[model samples]
Target chain A: DAGITQSPRHKVTETGTPVTLRCHQTENHRYMYWYRQDPGHGLRLIHYSYGVKDTDKGEVSDGYSVSRSKTEDFLLTLESATSSQTSVYFCAISEKDPQETQYFGPGTRLLVL
Target chain B: SQQGEEDPQALSIQEGENATMNCSYKTSINNLQWYRQNSGRGLVHLILIRSNEREKHSGRLRVTLDTSKKSSSLLITASRAADTASYFCATVVSNFGNEKLTFGTGTRLTIIP
Candidate 1:
């Protein structure tokens, strides 16, 4: 599993509430990414971190945020959840090299109602 | 707005048969990668083929990249019921780091026993 883990494998919450998901990795990879997958959408990049405190928005970054304060942990937060945000979230890590392969975490399934 | 798009949104095959999926990308890329995901699960890395490389193989999987056509193909030979899953192709452009991956919509494969 590439030593990657995501907490709260399944979660259900009501709209307008705050939610946070955690991704931890044993490997000290330099890059971490958060993505959301839904039917017919495959996977859409939400946010990515190149280094601690250095992050960038992806194509679908609205309503979500990410923080990487340490090399081993990356967090995704939803300031105010909405039903449209319901999807499976995955965290992936890769080496600093541009051509390195990415390893994914088990994923967190979030449902907002 | 997806950089990569896959054809045949779904595929069905019997055990011991070969399953082939195609992915087309809109722009030039440095490399392409394939990934597999079981229903309601995270994605697993499969194979990667660089732009300079035409084909690659790992176990029962074979990947072919055609840079001129901006496309790639994944073939799982002698597939099994366990191989039933969704397959996606990701492309890495000329980005400096690991932020290069752009995933396709994916193809859902059903392996009938």
Candidate 2:
């Protein structure tokens, strides 16, 4: 609905392998976020970007990293993926305004074997 | 740690019934928002109630916020089969620049025909 799309809708990889998920938005929103959803864990923030080249860590940023070199694309990479990182990842974008509602992408499901 | 906790981890209701879910948070919030996820898909923004607002409504959805109790509730009137999904509540804390949202574990709703 927000012109947001996440690449690699589903993936299964062996442990210790590196994986990168991409989120692209046509809306050119100023804020972008990456979150992971797991059983009994709800949705936890991994990383977020306020603008291009400006990013910050979140609650679960241990094994994940994010980059936003441009306004339209935000990338999440799991360096040496682990089994604990197996979950559904969602990307969201919102305006700079604090009261603006966030729009989410379709999500990517990753399984680490 | 999770910022918000939703009550009634799972709910079952008939198609014409009303479904209600409650969320409680620990810290002060600037606003509270609701989101819905359809199975394996991404989450969709449903409604948002600002700290200054007491109640808000959209279509068949009604949201009420009580900052004094640090809690919020979502009510879906005349819920349909399509409304069956996982509902989550997110809170925006009173921080400066980035308004990072923390989401609840979610309440799974099953609509019986």
Candidate 3:
């Protein structure tokens, strides 16, 4: 409902394979964030971008990387997929402050075998 | 470790009854927000309560924050069948302009229709 869409709503890949998930927003928000949701572990932030080409790591950024080359597109990449990386990934956008309410996309379900 | 922990992983109630969910955190926070997520879908922002504010109301939703106890609660009155979903509470902590949000595992609410 926020004009945000995540590509490849469902994906299954083998371990050690490279996988990239894309988040596109039409709101032209300045802040974009990536999070992963797992059972019993809640949602953990993977990475976020404040502006074009500006990014930062989050609490669970161990095996994930993000890039925001443009205002509307934010990409999350897993250089090598692992079984532990299997989870539902969500992308969120905020107009300005990180402390404000965020709008989320539909989310992508990834499975690593 | 700053993640909020929501009580009662799952709850079931009648459609017209009220549902209350509690969240507790371990650190000082700048603000707290509640979100709702339908199965296999993304999260939607519900309400927000700042640390300095004791309570805030939005429609049928009421959010209360107690900084002294490091806890927050969400109350939804006159629940509807469509209100059945997983509710999450996220905490925002800031340190030197770097703010981080940690989400709880979420409480799954089912309204008996």
User: Whose lDDT is greatest here?
Assistant: 3
Compute the TM-score of each model's chain A versus the native chain A and list the values: 0.97, 0.96, 0.99
**What DockQ does each listed candidate score?**
0.68, 0.71, 0.88
Comparing 1 and 2 on TM-score, the stronger one = 2
TM-score-best of 2 and 3: 3
Check candidate 1 and list the clashing pairs: none
Error of 3 at B94 (Å): 2.1
TM-score for candidate 3 = 0.98
* lDDT (tens digit, per residue) of candidate 1 on A46-87: 998888998999879999999999999999999999999999
**What is candidate 2's lDDT per residue for B6-107, written digit by digit as tens?**
988999999999999999999999999999999878889999899999999999999999999999999999999999999999999977765778899999
Give candidate 2 regions above 4 Å deviation: none
Q: Measured with DockQ on alpha carbons, how good is candidate 2?
A: 0.71
Compare candidates 1 and 3 on DockQ and give the better one: 3
Q: Please provide, for model 2 over A43-98, each residue's C-alpha lDDT reduced to its tens digit, 9 standing for 90 to 100.
A: 88899888999999988999998999999999999999999999999999998763
iRMSD for every model: 1.6, 1.5, 0.7
TM-score value, chain A, candidate 3 = 0.99
Docking class of 2: medium
Q: Model 1's lDDT to the true fold?
A: 0.91
Q: For model 2, name the residue pairs that clash.
A: none
